[model samples]
Target: MVTHINLKRCIGCQFCVQVCPRGCFEYDFEINKVKLVNPILCLKCRACELNCEGDAIRIEKPIFQNFFAQLI
Candidate 1:
């Protein structure tokens, strides 16, 4: 799974930075916006996507992975 941030549409709200459980999102002072800094740390929890008001973040769901995860 991969997460994408549409900087062009981002409103710099920083909600994603606050909601991510794994500290995947970080605030960029130079850009005056939030950025996903640690993709590997992301838990695919959708907390950032659900809380983002700017609709700037997009995440690819781990569909097939979830099925395999159940079997493990």
Candidate 2:
């Protein structure tokens, strides 16, 4: 799973880049944008999503188990 940054929404504030513990983001100077650098190391803590003012970032996570089956 990885986080996706919507370039259109991102304001290039670099808040997400700075808050990530795994160093998953990098700033592209030429385009004035943010890029996902290392995705595998992402802890999925949702820090970036919460911090993003423009709602540019989304953390995608797969369902670990079926809820109905587990309940049964």
Candidate 3:
């Protein structure tokens, strides 16, 4: 899964940072925005997107089978 953080709309709520079960989001003190810290840990769960009040995060759904094939 690929997650993108839109810094513009983010208000430093840290809600996304708190809700991600895999610890995917991190609070960046300098930018005051939540960032994707470990994308590979993401389970493609929409919890972040649903909890983000500012709608600042987006997740890209990957065609996993196709992606896996590229490694060969």
Candidate 4:
């Protein structure tokens, strides 16, 4: 799941908005920044975090999920 987005570091580039497969992010023209609109829909794929040039996105997986992922 996505846990945080530091607006101060976000460059309004919309990379996360474009890369999110679940449409969890949106570009807010009023603020010229990206917003996490549907965090519940996040798939924890890290696509948003990896694509964010500003490194403003953070995703946290459950401990069990991390352990299972390591096994795979």
Estimate the overall C-alpha local distance difference test score of candidate 2: 0.83
* Candidate numbers, best lDDT first, in rank order: 2, 1, 3, 4
Q: Give the TM-score (vs. native) of candidate 2.
A: 0.79
- The 0-to-1 C-alpha lDDT of every candidate, in the order given, reads 0.83, 0.83, 0.82, 0.81
Which candidate, 2 or 3, would have the higher lDDT against the true structure? 2
lDDT of 3 by residue, 6-69 (tens): 8999999988888899998889899888878888778878898888989988887667646663
Ranking by TM-score: 3, 1, 2, 4
* Per-residue lDDT of model 2, residues 1-72, tens digit only: 557889999888999988988898999998888888887677789999999877899987556745563234
The number of the candidate with the highest TM-score is 3
For model 3 the TM-score comes to 0.80
lDDT of 3: 0.82
lDDT of 4 by residue, 45-68 (tens): 887888888999888755553445
Which regions of candidate 1 deviate over 4 angstroms?
A: 61-72
Worst 10 residues of 3 by lDDT: 63-72
Misplaced by over 4 Å in model 3 are: 62-66, 69-72
Task: Tell me how far the alpha carbon of residue 72 in candidate 2 is from the true structure, in angstroms, after superposition.
Answer: 30
Better of 1 and 4 by TM-score: 1
- Look at candidate 2 and tell me the lDDT of residue 15: 91
How many residue pairs clash (N, CA or C atoms closer than 3 angstroms) in each of the candidate models, in the order given? 0, 0, 0, 0
Evaluated at residue 21, the lDDT of candidate 4 is 82
